[model samples]
Target: STYRLLSLVLVEGARVQPHYIADTSRRSTLLELRTMHHIRQAVAALSPEGAARIAPTRIVSVHDIAPAPEITARRNRLTRRAYLGGQYDWLARFAAQFDIPALELCIHVDDKAHAFISEHVEQVEGEYWQLRKELVDTDLSLFRYFRFPVLHLTKLEMDRLARQHGFHEIMQKTWFCHSPWRGRPCGICNPCVYTAEEGMAHRLRPLARLSYTLLPVLSVVREARRFVRRVVKR
Candidate 1:
């Protein structure tokens, strides 16, 4: 249902619509489509060829739901409440097009992410926490329209359950990319940076892993160089 966490906690026999918005990004590639393609392939391969357990991932067009592409996160960026609301509302309409009961959004909240959000509490003006919180609150309207509840599951818990089911390595097979080079992570983009910080090293390559692992040192060095320039100017 998302380009984020790979949902391995699929309910057996439940009609799950693993849908994605086939919206083109600034990078010129439909990264969601590519990622979901890999996910669908992995999901199908996991449970056996042509498994009836999980439904195929759906690719709903952005133009089909929203009036224009300007409302997307890529264009509008989730700064304003109205922009964020528009984004979620578009998704709600997309879901409403289907006769499904409700949408289940898989949210992966880790200690690192929680700490990051807490640290940025003072900078709530267009921060990820603020915008995400506002958009998440719209789940109520989504549920009311669909007449069902949207489930938010943690990645840690899902991993635990995956281990129980003997398929804890599905994430390694999943894909998350906004800007990819030769189908590999660019290792410097926002999604790649976050992917590194979130401790998915096993899924990423050496360069991507190093980009995140060395980010702190790089930041400090950059600041030190800037200070030296300032002193020289003085």
Candidate 2:
């Protein structure tokens, strides 16, 4: 959804200094890379002649860098504080270097569609709109280049926008899995779950769809395990 929005932003005369941040913690796979390429191609196909001015995407790896302890401590409830902090820090520096005034993020407060989900909360809580806004406004305040084009729209709204703009096919090709098992989406992962719940289960493969069907039972088992742990502690 975000990718399609970004592509539209570029098509509508938003100059893009393309960069892809590869976070090791997320375990992005070859499938994602291929889909990304296709998205780029789709964008290029829409560009007017000689207007394919979008730069080649520069892949920036955050595998070796530890998230700053201060940043992590501030957002202890959120699992990817360090990763998010680190990405913003690097982006700020990069923007400064190139004199880029705006960095557009496809964050939708309505759907809490920022990349990171919290370990301490249920999926809905993890995507709590206000909580995500606070994280962006507080911890990620290092740069003034932040611009959110779709901040007020929900995921479903974004889909509607894509479909209205005739990019629904490309939207279907976009990748969302944070973890891939054997080159397929790990159906129980947060991204997969969100995708399914958001009415994009058709995006998942047959095997993933099967796994998604078991999600409710899996949730029950997880809660039972947590309950047993709490009882043991008591």
Candidate 3:
């Protein structure tokens, strides 16, 4: 979605970065690199006129582990809040060093951002959940150089935009798995679930699709567990 959004804009060149979780499988990372390589090759194969329309892009790696040790002090355990904070911190430094005017973040709009935060506040875990009791705000407006280009669009909306802009093929090359099994996406992961729920199951492998088929049953089991936990707490 972010890539598709960038394709519509006028930019000299693009530097793609992929963030990695220390403990999870590196399948997504590998896929990202491959996809970028494929894209560059496709661009190179294009006619000069066609290639000129697309921005030259390259992959750049940054220090992704423990960008915020205070919150992600536990080894291989980084919360979403801390992860994002770390990313913003790095972008701030990068922008200052290069004298860049502004930085655009391709984060899509989460309709349930507030709801998710509220629901997970009492829970022990969640990537996007707040680790501190006093901080309930989920807004990422503190970064002055950060601009959210797709802040108003949902994942489904982004899909529509991609199709409308003829970048759906490029978008299809994107990877979204956090925990992959044998180089394939684990369909039960948040990204897989969202992809299935957002009407993109055709992209998932057959086994992942099978797992997605059982998602309703799994959802029921989760709700039951949550209900029992709430009852026991009361």
Q: TM-score each candidate.
A: 0.57, 0.66, 0.56
Per-candidate Cα RMSD to the true structure, in Å, reads 8.6, 7.7, 9.7
Number of clashing pairs per prediction, in order: 0, 0, 0
For 1-234, candidate 2 gives per-residue lDDT tens digits of 345345445445555566666665667656777887887677657654313655567675655344455444434433354334334455544544555554555555434325543221122333222233444455443423445555456677777877776666667767888788777787888778878887777778999999899988989999999999999999
What lDDT tens digits, residue by residue, belong to model 3 across residues 177-198?
Answer: 7677887888888778877876
Worst 10 residues of 2 by lDDT: 119-128
Pairwise lDDT winner, candidates 1 and 2: 2
| lDDT, ranked from best to worst | 2, 3, 1
In angstroms, how far off is 37's CA in candidate 1? 4.3
Instruction: Give me the candidate number with maximum lDDT.
Output: 2
What order do candidates take by TM-score, descending? 2, 1, 3
Model 2 alpha-carbon drift over 4 Å, by segment? 1-11, 25-27, 46-51, 64-67, 77-101, 113-145, 222-234
- Model 3: residues with Cα > 4 Å off, grouped in runs: 9-25, 43-100, 111-143, 215-234
Cα-based lDDT for every prediction:
0.50, 0.59, 0.52
User: What is the C-alpha RMSD, rounded to one decimal, of candidate 3?
Assistant: 9.7
Error of 3 at 129 (Å): 23
Q: What ranges in model 1 sit over 4 Å off?
A: 1-11, 26-45, 68-90, 96-100, 110-153, 214-234
